[model samples]
Target: MTYKANLTQYLSNEFKRLYEEPFNTDVTVQVGEEGHSKIFQAH
Candidate 1:
């Protein structure tokens, strides 16, 4: 897999983990140089 693919996969997993508590966590998947990142901010 390419670097971006790997990063995307990693970010996807992070989203799953963060989204576990959908009511509490504001999980956002954003595109970046690497591929993606999960941003979590308390609401």
Candidate 2:
């Protein structure tokens, strides 16, 4: 698999793991290069 594919899979798994647990607030995940990052929110 390519780097992009691996990264996507990694982030997907992280999100799944986070969501699988009980939480009372929003969750944010950071994904991107060293100098730049994007945030993804899940509740």
Candidate 2 overall Cα lDDT vs. reference?
0.53
Worst 10 residues of 1 by lDDT: 33-42
lDDT by residue (1-43, candidate 1, tens digit) is 9999999999999987765455343334332423224333333
The 10-residue segment with the lowest total lDDT in model 2: 34-43
- Which residue pairs in candidate 1 have backbone atoms (N, alpha carbon, C) closer than 3 angstroms, thus clashing? none
Best by lDDT: 1
lDDT of 1 at 20: 48
lDDT of 1: 0.55
Looking at candidate 1, what is the lDDT of residue 4?
A: 100
| Candidate 1 residue-wise lDDT at 33 | 28
lDDT tens digits by residue: candidate 2, 1-43: 9999999999999987775542433332333343222223233
